[model samples]
Target: MTALMKQNIRRITTVLVSSAMSAFATVQTVGNFSVLSMNTAGLPDFLQGNDVPGDKTENHRMIGAKFVEYGYDIINVQELEFKLNLGQDFNYHAALYSTASLPYRTPTSGGVPFGSGLNTLSRYSFTDTTRVKWNDCSNFGGADCLTPKGFTLVRVLLSSSPEGYAYVDVYNIHADAGVTNADLVARASNLRQLSEYIDNWSAGNAVIIAGDTNSRYTRVRDEIRILTRENGMTDPWVELIRDGVDPTEETICANPTTLSYCETVDKMFYRSSPVLNLQAIGWSYESSRFLQPNGDILSDHNPIVATFSWSLPASLRQSELYGGPHDTWFSDTGVLSRIFSPRISTIRFRGGSRLDAVSVAHVDGTSITHGGTGGRASELKLTDGETWTEAKLCLGQRNNRTGVFAIKARTSAGRTLTAGSSTEDCAEFVAPGGWGIVGFVGGSGSEIDKLGFLFAPH
Candidate 1:
């Protein structure tokens, strides 16, 4: 071929590559990360390796190597404790930490017979790290009370997202073992304690909880629903692997390694934040990856890995949706429904004993109303330079039905509007620093059943 023809072909290839790159860039808002949760079976060397194969310290070294090899972004490990006078250069903690590629790690909570045997290793920096001991434990089940088995929390800073800095609260828990009645009660209490702590501390934040739960979804009286139902967490295994169905007692597998439906005690749960949306993209038991050179397993329990895809909305950040179930859902961020103006000019509440409806008017002369039109209407208007800053909503029972009983809206300029009856069962939604409320999202029919806030950077 002629030199001119060859040059033309090269130009065509360049254009095609550029077009593909541009298409990829348009969808760069979504980011992905992976987490691995394992019960390392790191009992003391004298405990005969807790019935798991291989030397305790050596197995830890291999586990760390495998973690790095698999490129897990975060690792939550249970039963990884250090022991004194083991006559080795390093204990289990040092063996794993020194070998893993993850730069940030929490020190072992304590050693065997005393510590919580929980640790977290991550590639991202973390803060507000805390460990809480279980308030209830039963000696009838597996000596759970002997060690301070509970949960650990770390606020991980994910700086690598497309939109810059994001924070996620990560938790690692190890509940009471055994199936005795006392064991079940103590495990239930453990889950309740964690749920309360999450509601208090991690509210409105992205969260991921994983580790050896010592409880099963199929097991009666497990109380695992507290985390999912009460806290709005999603189990990745159930969602991705089990097709959104929990296994029954008859379907429980004795050897999860050989089965596709593996529901083990080692589990992972996650929820999204207002600013960040997280979805489980993949789930795996990871049994083959943790095998020893001799083809034996690394631990008595297989490690579970979950891959998550996260994205940030173009401009709006949402607060947690609150209140009761409704027939329909609405969000101000919808393409055809979003408020065109950056500032909310007016908020009108219609209610008396219970909230009936809400209407928001924007500076651009566009307005949207939701809920039933049965109650008295009250409006709060914002002057120039004024911004909506917060909302307080109370949920209560009215006419034998549960719904929003009170609604209050406050502006940065000290203006306030309140409607309906006041109650103690309330939640406050406030904009984060450098952010302001832009709009609202909720469900409404004859009455406003649920409510949430929308935020944008000021």
Candidate 2:
């Protein structure tokens, strides 16, 4: 095994010992810099007036270069014919695509013959996967209305660090953008079914379901929100919009107006227990004026990119100190982190030696420290709460190693008779992976047994 692997094995041993002792620990860091893009809109048949009818390989290279510029790790592409060679040029270790056959039409001069489907690319390794296909092509009528075959699901292991194994599910789809409403509903149902499948297999796994749903209408976006959000999933784009993300033009349809860049048709969505930080989101619509002797643009749909940072619970430390689940759990399609109370007393932590550091969650009046852990600790404190409240543990570097440890609770007034810091009394519960929070309540005669530790790592 490699050095990292050896360290992982050693940590597992420590975790076993720590669980015997108490438990606890997280990032898909946004600053890592990543992007996802697509829309070569290639079709099987040829046509006369269609100058560049979107070639799958050309689109792939263009999107890949865009990602390279922005330092993106993942790319979701749509309208790929599956015939393009990705053997070495793309350089993705784990890639997934669907062969959803579509009717062959006339091809544009010098363009690809024709094909249909979606594809996903990743630089990281992938494990535990599934593929889903849809049948909405029937919605289109007559010889001109060609229905698409379906979609695909590819699940990847996000982290197998000393802390735990987390996952992310990516789905690539090219829904019939020609129709709306019921057709969109059918596609949404199909996606939901896939989500349910993942839920059954990996309960607490992070998921990213994206594609060219062709649901550019307001209703379709709403339906998507319901399918994911109602099921505990969060849309990374919507989250970015909430965080104030700006949009860029990737494709421009030539019209008399010359100002026809419209619709957020292509997209990428994610849902999970961890707080997914919306790092960057934008479309690829740079001008082609510099590329040709006579300015010419390629492709119809501009590829879209979305970057995320995973923020899971801190319960792993507690689990290590006390013992946590070897498997995972999910609320629906999203993973579930251990719940922590604003008020804390006991900290069931994992690996920690005299050389390692540990910090406690502190509460000051109305503020909370989220349990900061690093270096040595004399006593863990939270911003004082007149009312019993819960907070999180902020553990730093020593995070990945240290097992669970214990923390004694006392009033700022120096009264120790009130609370007992023990996972046994606190009803210790493990967070799905290894991050979570402890719950504490305050009263004249408060029950301190409910007080536990909530830890989140990096």
Candidate 3:
């Protein structure tokens, strides 16, 4: 009787797991409405004195138009002080702050306020906005005393409609640049405060807190760990990448194409609320493409974009278990399993296109679907009449490479499995500069397995 009871439990668990897999096959298909988040490449140069051809207002208009073209609903702007005519041209509602004039300090090189750092602009009507003041406990009586800058928080309500009010809170931080250790600690503290504030204000509402949180060193990474583990906010960009959506872009760099050492400093964080369903998050060089034949690095930082669907389950905010220090793949497999991780894992797709008609096959069966190309935005799913098995996956792309597709599965024994690009390549969607697929196989295998392929361009 005990053995029979155990068998029944095992069967139930298997059915539940299979149902979840089927649901995975249907990801990103929900109610249509969505909201997106992005960092405003950087403030326009009239603010920075880069000596381009236009006045501050004109320059802002040009850049503002470019930002709008990217379809960003909310934008966080760093170095707001550098832009001479900062807010004159942009039509969106905005808030700006800086620490430049904080007591006991010489003006910043760019002449923006110190401590008074990050700012934000938005297309949707913001119900209210406020800045969290910095602590001035440090008093270096010297002629050039270094005063600490306070982190700034901007609260924007998405709507005033009686629909119970859902809002995304934006917390922007520009920590100390050169000093590695101290900078991370300070930034972490600021992030904790921001997270606490959001948690306090909206409790269970959808919350998105983003900015340039510089977490590189071991110390900073530790703080980030605290943020994720304790605060329950997920880094959608990182999570999506783990799910096979390479949304990273070369944002902070000494020069274009030649990336600097400190990449991924800028990031977006999402609260795990059922209301805040992160659909796709990515970065864009769309504005950079418009740069005149002349050379200018748009803004020093890259713009990170996150798309959210209102109906996605809260589970979407839970980071998936893959490709990390303590990931599920770690204990289960070794060696070759390591190669299964993406070699050149993160690359921001510049062109915004769509990948159409892609397919995926599990050990049990197969299915198909589609998504945008370029950034970590590609889509594929089960076709029909086929349940997924252990190792088989087939995907085809139609729109050049507008999207990205990744693979995840479980063996019959219930061991979780993860891997890199699928064998199926998009021979069909191959266009001049379009969308397509990068496939992966599920089970323990050696050698490329071609499920199928598709191609398209926009």
lDDT of 2 by residue, 189-248 (tens): 655655565555434445666666655435543255554544565555545543433233
Q: What digit string (tens of lDDT, one per residue) describes model 1 on residues 246-311?
A: 778535444228675856888899998655789999998888888889888888887889999888
What range of 10 consecutive residues in model 2 has the weakest lDDT sum? Answer: 441-450
Candidate 3, residue 254: how far the Cα is off, in Å: 6.3
Q: Write the per-residue lDDT of candidate 3 for residues 216-335, one digit (tens) a residue.
A: 423433266555666676766566644533333333433333331334556666663432444444433233433433666444455555666544331111111111111011011111
- Residue 89 lDDT, candidate 3, scale 0-100: 41
Give the number of the best model, judged by TM-score: 1
Q: Which parts of model 2 have CA positions greater than 4 angstroms off? A: 1-33, 45-70, 82-116, 139-148, 158-160, 180-202, 220-222, 242-262, 274-295, 316-458
Poorest lDDT segment (10 consecutive residues) of candidate 1: 158-167
Model 1 RMSD in Å is: 13.0
- The best candidate by lDDT is 1
TM-score of each: 0.66, 0.49, 0.44
- State in Å the error of residue 412, model 2: 33
